[model samples]
Target: MSGAAVDAASGAPRRGEPRPKAAATNQQLRQQAVDRMIEAAIALIAVKGAAGLTLVDVGRAAGYSHTLPNYYFKSKNELLRQAYGRSVGAFRRRSGAWRRQALRAPVRDDALFSTMLAYVHGGCADPAGARAVNLIAAEAVTSLPGLLPEVRLQNERMLALLQDRIEAGACGTGAAEAPASIEALLVLAALRGLVSQHLLGVPAADVDAAVRMLHGFIEGGPAGGRSAA
Candidate 1:
């Protein structure tokens, strides 16, 4: 229980100084702090929006001293970027897990639909992360080269999965030929709009219905009946 063997939950060490055997646990505690700070940022961003959230706010929310955030993260943007990465990483993990699970089930329309439904629902559940991601996406387009490679890669992976399912004819006929990249962009746009509307105090039922409609549209239903113009 040396300093190197600090407990992440309590942020306290078993002993006053480090021991060679306890180095790994100490590193684990540091990682846990970084992770906890990111999580706190997510919650605060959701409630106050990214523009309104501060390092001090994030630290307090995460049960750390006001200065602790600075020790872990150099600036607000750095913290945000890390939080954004964590959020996207979580989404990828979920999608990957769902895909792996689907491989074991009987292939059917329901399976594809269910997977897509869960994907959209997961995004909806964390509106703050969704919003932050959308913001980063918009910026990445013009910010700098390779500024958000991970985000872009995650997006591509999501689109590829949808494309594969559609091509397999599980979703329907048009899906096979539809541009997966375009479809993914459209779906992300719709999700951002829906989340934004909700954040602006739009009714929950309306937001939920809109998301469902979007899911239907993506699955080759009559959801996208309107013209882009």
Candidate 2:
């Protein structure tokens, strides 16, 4: 089985040299170790919940001694904060780039749904980042006292961006639901659910079906509805 952390190039590890996943890379990956630590921390938090995580556990999970994380991060809270920030920052970057593409293309079904599909698919592709985001968000919903205020501010901005883009694309198209903010929140909620299933050890086939269902609904295809009962 492939490692949970994606390979830098092929997105899955190669069969060559061992992965120097700690903060010991050369000039190119000076932050590779740090990145791995964040990924391990994210995955652990997803499986163990926020309060169950510890610096020692995070370090051991990242394939290093328990003190490795301590050298880089002062505490578990700091590590979680940094991991959450990095995840959101990446999403913002991807969404911004997609929005630029949307600016060039017409806001028709072809453009809008394609962009949204890619956006959703990207998260599914990067499982570590997706798990981190959902776990951090879940943590915030229950106990946000330790999370940084900037994280909340970043989320607000992201939601605003989603809503604004939806409004722009749906202008006169009559496709978007009322209150674009609510629609945006719904989409975001679906993404959270997607990540939740993955972290909870759901079957890959089922997870793929969920992603497909979301894409279908976004593209005006059948939602693949099933009885909840």
Alpha-carbon lDDT, every model = 0.66, 0.66
Q: What lDDT, from 0 to 1, does candidate 2 have? A: 0.66
Off by over 4 Å in 2: 1-33, 90-111, 148-150, 172-177, 194-229
Which consecutive 10 residues in model 2 have the weakest lDDT in total? 220-229
**lDDT by residue for model 1 (1-229), tens:** 6445456456664456574454558789899988899999977765665656689999999999999999889887788778778878776566557656766777543544555545655565567776666665655566533436766786776667665654454454335546766666676566557666766678767765665566566655463422200
Residue-level lDDT for 196 in candidate 2: 61
Model 1 TM: 0.60
lDDT of 1: 0.66
Per-residue error for 162 in candidate 1, Å, reads 2.3
Estimate, for each residue in 60-101, the C-alpha lDDT of model 2 and write its tens digit.
998887998988898878888887888777765675576566
Q: Candidate 1: list runs displaced more than 4 Å.
A: 1-24, 92-112, 127-147, 170-173, 191-229
lDDT score of residue 173 within candidate 1: 35
